[model samples]
Target: MSHANAALTPRHRLRIARLIVDEGWTVVAAAHMFNVSWPTANRWAQRYAAMGVAGMDDRSSRPHRSPNKTDQQLVRKIVHLRWKKRLGPVAIGGKLGLSASTVHAVLVRCRLNKLHHVDVRTGEVIRRYEHATPGAMIHVDVKKLGKIPDGGGSRYVGRQQGNLNIRATAGRPKNNKRGRVAGITFVHTVIDDHSRIAYAEVHANETADTAVGVLRRAVSWFAARGVTVERVLSDNGPAYVSHLWRDACNELGIKPKRTRPYRPQTNGKIERFHRTLADGWAFGKFYNTDSARNNALPGWLHEYNHHRPHTAIGNRPPMSRLTNVPGQYN
Candidate 1:
């Protein structure tokens, strides 16, 4: 196949081949006309002779057969072991006397890389789920991040310096056991089910009141941009089940929903957002102080909503999918 920026297309190849074969032009003349090598022109001419115009079309460069490829018999055995035993790659490799990577590669080629892709009992494909409307449902969740030391965290300062910062902030206890605990920050996140536009805030705790407050602000933010929160989905955390959270949702006329017990994937959107949040913001840079990290959230949030492209949204920012409101946070 031609490269993304290839100078000649299949049509050009066909034309060059016809010039050499039908017009009786020499290979050198055809190559000179197309600004390509004589061998390139000759190959096309040979293809035309063997299969006519269709043969001149671009074809994959991959070899038709790989002699060194794993035998199909061995691949079938690997698949059977995965289905029968549900063993992980390393364990399967150990049983078969193959390297873990080799087993994994075999599984990938056979479409068994993830257990979820196959039914444990029947080995059938599991259907995936998706919502169709922006803000028809919203995912709400909390991710707990360890607070940075007062001055800076170990990420910025050396481990020893970080220990000193912790000691300075917590002070040595009277019993001389250890410094006070470094508090945790709960990041409350809400994302649209369809567009995946997300809102997040760092708070001292993930109490019911804090969750309700964050939801309120998130609703307002989405409302300004034309999305009305119809349903709020979360895990069965105490904060989500609390009467305070329910009352707040009732006031906003939004339904509150929870994921099945121990099934975090029911609220998978926010969970995935947490991963992106960690990679892109929370641990993406070194900050001298926690306040610096906190201050950076708004800019990152703006970028997430208005600038950063999302793969699921066809590489456009989530704001592009929003309707009935201004396209940006502004």
Candidate 2:
């Protein structure tokens, strides 16, 4: 493409060049007529004389050669570290005794500047795909968050006080000799692949029974929004692979699918939703009590579904995908 400051487009260049070469117009006259420099007009005429019409097009600004560029062997090493080791520029620089900026420039040239651009499973560029319609397939996952003590966690109160609350309110009594385990809330989520609409429930455990119950509610919730789930996708977690989960899917008349072992990317939608859940709701606000935070989830989820703009779906709220629903609009 021509730069903004260029005097003429390829069409105009061809016109001016033909005027000078074929029409026998002087370079200075063609330059004056086209409101360009004499040298620019003369250059185009010369290129046309040698290379024909192709010479009138834009040319790459990159230099033909760079003597100081990294050697091919070193370039191969840099690329190897990026794909094999998944190291960042700074780490690669440190390991190879090169400057981080140098390493970064190389990464940019190789189109490996962002780690997400590479697929860990195939060592190739990441190719993203989505199912055709809402509920054609839904991804399921669980996010385990540390439950704030009754008073609060360190984010709001002081860290020392937070530790005190944890010890005082431990699932095990303080008098027990065994080490205490603080509370953990498992947030089970189901997200539609095509629309990015999601539903979730916070539970005390990630047991198969809890997972199955959450799936049932999620299916009903999506049905209310005018989407009937056809299939469910989840990781091969114990809860997801259990007999209870299988029977639940059978009763719901939905097919169940699992990602390949150790490959979470096969179920990337719900994995991404868990990150969004943590950032936008779970830790977005400081809560004085766990109960208060739990109560806030439904409100946040409503906003996410009805109001919040989601980039993956053109910055409209997830409810936009359910336009056929009676109460879809504000």
Q: Each prediction's Cα lDDT score?
A: 0.84, 0.86
So what's the TM-score on candidate 2?
0.76
Per residue, candidate 1 scores C-alpha lDDT tens digits across 1-330 of: 777677568888889988888999999988998899988889988998899988966778879988978788888889888987788889988888888998999988887888976655655455556688777899999999867767777676877887777677653234422543356778999999998998998998899989999999999988878887899999999999999999999999999888889867568678889999999999999876677899999999888888899998899999888645664557
Per-residue error for 36 in candidate 2, Å, reads 12
lDDT tens per residue, model 2, 146-248: 7787677777677777776667664633543332234678889988999888889999899999999999999988887778899999999999899999999
Candidate 1: C-alpha RMSD to true structure equals 7.3
Q: Residue 325 in candidate 2 has what lDDT?
A: 75
Candidate RMSDs in Å, in order, are 7.3, 4.7
**What ranges in model 1 sit over 4 Å off?**
1-110, 113-126, 170-181
- Candidate 2, backbone clash total: 0
Clashing pairs in 1: none
- Give the clashing pairs for model 2: none
